[model samples]
Target: MPTVRIPGPPGLPLIGSMVDLARQPLQAMLAAQRDYGDVVRFAFGPPGLRGEIYAVFSPEGAHQVLAGQAANFRKESTLYEEVRSTVGNGLLTAQDADYQRQRRLIQPLFTRRRVDGYAGAVAVEAAALVERWSAVPGGVVEAVAEMSRFALRTVSRILFGADVEAAVDVVRGAFPVLGEYLLARSFSPLHAPRSWPTPANRRALAAQRELYRVCDGIIARRRAAGPGKAEGAGDLLGLLADARTEDGERLDATELRDQVLIFLLAGHETTATSLTFALHLLGRHPEVQRRARAEVGEVLGGRAPGVADVEQLSYLTMVLKESMRLYPAAGIFGRRAVEACEIGGHEIPAGADVMVSPWVTHRHPGHWPEPERFDPERFTPEREAARHRYAWYPFGGGPRACIGQYFSMLESVLALAALLQAFEFEAVDREVPIGQGLTLQAEGPVRVRLTPRSL
Candidate 1:
């Protein structure tokens, strides 16, 4: 084992680096990577207190941690624990055999052929969103809120089908609260127990119950409709309810609820963040906006985008990719070293919290020439092909990669195309500040002005 002690700033004793991490995570991370090398260490607290986070900012280290030697790492970080507590033991936080089994059963559903089936549903939601924006009193809309609404409706419709409307009310505004609650818990060294009924805990738990209640009710309705009805319903809930393992085991009621809740959380809010930022970026760059809109017009020609359009809207896809690079939804993810391992030429012992940050790695000067500039050109085929595979993993990489990636891209492309076809954006808030949450979220409204597009 190469026992070269990783270099990093040892902050104030007892709560080493916690203040910096909790105050401005992104900035602190960037500074850490830029000042220290690719593999840097940051203590979370005093000695033997969860030790220190070994952050991998190099593509090589990212590949090692996330994919190459994945077996040596486990999703056992406090952050993941927080998420598992709030949501459930769904795909995001499942471990070992549970994760493998769930992945095997759920993987087939997200195949290109099956996921593309939801494109029309995505297009319908996109069209509705474009129309909704048209009705904004001043032709100005809050991009984050609007994208959330669109993504929520679209995911709900796909997940719940006929019961879509029943879920919207309960899920709306609940995730942010849950996200804050989770983040606070994830970072705090010591906190009151969740059962202690603190104000914040109460609000978060209430939000969780209502969200779960709505999903549970929908599942119950499907169950009442009978197995035949559920299997035949042709939606996510029905498919999950009907999914069986090789041993003929099906997800129990609680298991079914877990899947639905996770799907809603991951499927909707993340997509909304991607769309909001993509539009916000476009609003700030008219040249890129015109070019992207032109591509949309040339391809769609006033017709709604279909699944095939996803391939043809190449430029727009690049724009979204660039936005995600600048602000990834899953910016920083955590894993624990299961055993001693070497990454980026440093020795990592077992039980250390390992973190891979796409936000900082995506800006590595070695790969991206001008890291801060928003240039969709970087995603051009030739450039993308030449770069390291793990250099741009907005949706994550490896065995545990996001299953909804295909659907997310399809929805984003279709939504962007439709929105571009409907309106031309002018940035109202040119610079929208952001922070980390359940996903990369804006600190304030990402507002943009729209002028209806002429046929």
Candidate 2:
């Protein structure tokens, strides 16, 4: 194989491309791919703190790193370590045997059959949102905040069940704190250790403790209520608490807490982002919004949507897919190379930081013709089948793909369809800037003007 230095943009002495990256990570990554090829090398920081991220922006490269040569990469990035600090050994941050065992036990709980039971719960929340929006002083709402509320409420209800009302406020307040802390800690090349009493660390500690207390209290209540009390209930926590392996093993208390934290945070946050941007995009394109609404109207015919209806909301599903293609929640993720590997004919040194960006790859002109347009028809069956799978992986791809993929889809489709059926939206901000947190966040306001649908 020929050895060639990966081409990338150069920068000032100590910090290579850090300014541009910090300012606009998605745009920087895309520009890099446009200027260089699919594989690009970027170095930042200084000396001992220096970081070299090998950005893989092609479908083949993403496949190699995330699937084909998965064994050669480890989730030892700073980001995972930061998440582990709060989440313990949950599947999201666990490795090796622990991950395999967790996946085995938890996989059953997230299967289509099991998560389908969540549709009713999602519909309830969607209806609640519709009610809330109906009462707004004016027919306008901040799409980002409103979507976040809907998502957090839905996840809380599914996780906490009868006790949901109690947990919602606590979770909504505390998660943003923890998310901010996690983002800052993961990216900070130099900061006081978490154990130190810095204000940020102190605030993070308080938020972490508060969240754990809420989850712990709920778990205790469920345990005290016993099996008979929750027998017919299919809440996420109850399902996880009751999940038993073929050998009759179950997640212990600590493991239960870890998994619940992952679900509550990742679950709500990601779906909120998907819903927010889908709404934003739909509002931006009146024709697309009209078409999606027509599909929802035809499918539900004014009835509330449920799990059974999710699959039939085809055009709306495409709208969500295209939204995620443009604004994936987990826009960028990292893995550390454990063994030397070659991806896309470029040699990746062992211990190198490898970043795979769905935000960049999904916009590849090779896969998406007018990559920047809000085009939902791109997700039609024929077009989707013709494209490379990894090229549009909003939920990721491979063994480590998001376990909540279907659930997110179900929730997003149901909420979106319900909202679209109830109201027509016009974008107040045609272009919303994004800021990276634990999940992608829309910077500033994502405002949408709403008019109740005459139907």
Candidate 3:
């Protein structure tokens, strides 16, 4: 057996590497990679602690851990346990046979044919958003919030038949509470036991219940009304509500609830973040913005975008790809060793945590030239063809890849094309710092001035 080599900062007595990462996650990880080469390992938790864990980060190492010997690694128990407590055994948090079953059952809904059905709704909602924004005075609009609203509306229409304008407040009111609890739990050891009586956790759980209530009501009403009754009833909720497993078993109430919750959360928020970052990048690079606007103009000629129009908007797709490469919505994905394994010739013992950060890999010096420059052309078909398949995985890869990637890409292209056709945007302030959290969101509101495009 080849001897395993672990790279990264030397560990301190009793504390492992937690302090360095907590102080500055991005910089710390970058520095570790610089010092330790592509494959690096670091420990966390108190030194000599019974439950201390180690993690590895390398493009090749990550590939090996996630795809090469995947069975040896599993979704980190921390995330599984946390999500189970909040959302139950849905696809996002479930593992093994249950996850496999749910994935098999739900995969049909995200097929090209099914997701293409949503393009009209996406374009319609985006056009409405652009029309509403036309009235705002020339100054930086909060792109993050605006995109979130856009994505929420898109997801609601497709998932629950709700308009963005109508469902915005309900979803907005609910998500922050849920996000706060999830974020707090991610870093704090006291999280699990504090779900009771504490206001934050209580509010989060309440929000979860309320979300379920709304989805349940929508599902029941759709069922009661029968097929073809509701205007947009064929959305994800309806599909899942009526879908059957391979064995012909239908999703029970709890299973339906979990899938709905996952779609509601995952479908909108991450895409919104991606859109926000894309807009931010576009605003910063006016030339790229002009080219994108020109492409939209030439393609649709002022017509509202539809599913067919999406295929012609290749520049818009490149813009989104480049933006995600710079600021991936989900910055990092994590797993844990379920058994002792060798990755990059290094031993990863059972119970150790592993993280593959797109935030780092997407910007790896070895893979991308002039990594920080805002250049959309890098994603041109010719350019994209030159990169390794695993080199630019914004939505992840392998069996566990995000099932809604095509849906999101289509949604983003239509939304951007619609907005660009209707309005010309410029940054109010170009120096906003980005914060990496559950998603890559602006550290503060991204304000952009919008001027109506000459029709």
Candidate 4:
């Protein structure tokens, strides 16, 4: 085997790059890639500590870790275990066999045909959001909070059917607390044992219980409805309630709770962040916004956007793709080595953390010329076909890639088109407030001035 010889900045002792990383994560990672090449070694924890991490930031490196030798790296254990405090052994927290089984069981609910059906609901929610904005005076609207509310309402409508009001309070209350705690833990090297009665930990535990209560209530209601309910009822909760394993074993209440919790939390938050960032980008680039609005006008012709219109709104799709390329919601993510492996001529021992940052890789100078420019034309079919396969993985790559990708794309395209049709947006701030939490979000309200469109 080759000797382990990755290069990195030997950071300050005891603290070891944590200050730099915490303050400017995306810039720090990008600087490391520029200085040390594709695979850069990073030290965390105290002096002489064993916590050496590797960041992979090239298409080749990403392909190696996320696809080529994928079996050798698994989701980081400590982080996932922490997530399980709320999500339990759901798809995100499940291991090899359990994850495979769960995927099979839930896969039917997200089939292309079914996800397409959710488009009408997505457009309805977006239209309601437009109406709410119309009622308010047209000053700086909080784009981030508004998108979050819209995403939660849309997902709840799709998942819970007619019973959304029953679970909305608990879901809305629990997730912000849960996201703050998870984001802190994921970054901090010095969190106390979660069992300790600390204020943050107490909040986390309380939030977890609230989420469980909400999940339990949703499942109980579905069960009470009886399995004879038609699959055509078309809500996700109904389908999951009736899903059976290959052996014909139905999911128990606990399993049902886990799935619901993970779906509601993970599903809505990522989509909200994506939509928020997309709007921020569009608001800043009025030309792009105008072009997209033109497309929406020509295609929809004063009708609500549907799944069928997703393909026709090509520029709108390109704008969203370009926005995700620049500010990927799950920008910097992690995996852990399950066994010793070589990537880019460096040895990664089992349990060592590995990072694949879309924020870094998407901006890699080698893959994307003029990487910082906001030009959706770069995603044109001809240009995209010329790029590397792993060049722009906003939804990630490989078997463990996000399963909700199709749903998110369709939802974002429809919602974005609908918003553009209803209102024209102008940015309140010259520079956007970029924030990092469970996902990359706008730090403050992405205040935008909205003028009603003359449709």
Q: Give the TM-score of candidate 2.
A: 0.96
Q: Clashing residue pairs in candidate 1, if any?
A: none
**On a 0 to 100 scale, what is the lDDT of residue 446 in model 1?**
90
lDDT of 3 at 424: 77
Please report, in order, the local distance difference test score of every candidate based on alpha carbons. Answer: 0.86, 0.86, 0.75, 0.82
Clashing pairs in 2: none
RMSD of 3: 2.5
TM-score of each: 0.97, 0.96, 0.92, 0.95
Candidate 1: where are CA atoms >4 Å away?
46-51, 230-232
- Tell me how far the alpha carbon of residue 440 in candidate 4 is from the true structure, in angstroms, after superposition: 0.9
Q: Provide C-alpha RMSD values for all models, in order.
A: 1.6, 1.6, 2.5, 1.9
Which whole-number lDDT from 0 to 100 does residue 237 have in model 3? 74
The residue-by-residue lDDT of candidate 1 on 64-130, one tens digit each, is 8888988887889989998888889998889988888888778878999999998878877887887
Better of 2 and 4 by TM-score: 2
* Model 1 alpha-carbon miss at residue 12, Å: 3.0
For model 2, how big is the CA root-mean-square deviation?
1.6
Candidate 3 wrong stretches, greater than 4 Å: 1-5, 10-24, 47-55, 162-167, 190-195, 224-232
Best by lDDT: 1
Candidate 2 deviant stretches above 4 angstroms: 228-233
Candidate 4 per-residue lDDT, tens place, 1-455, comes to 55857888777777787666665667778889988988998776676543667899989889888888888878764456678765688887787888888888999888898788888779779889888988877446887888888998888888887877777778888888887787677665778888999999999899888777777876776687688474334588888878887899667889878888888877888888889878888989999999999999999999988888999999999999998898898778778888888787778777888888898989999988899898999899999999998899987888878888999999999999888989999887657756566677666667778888777
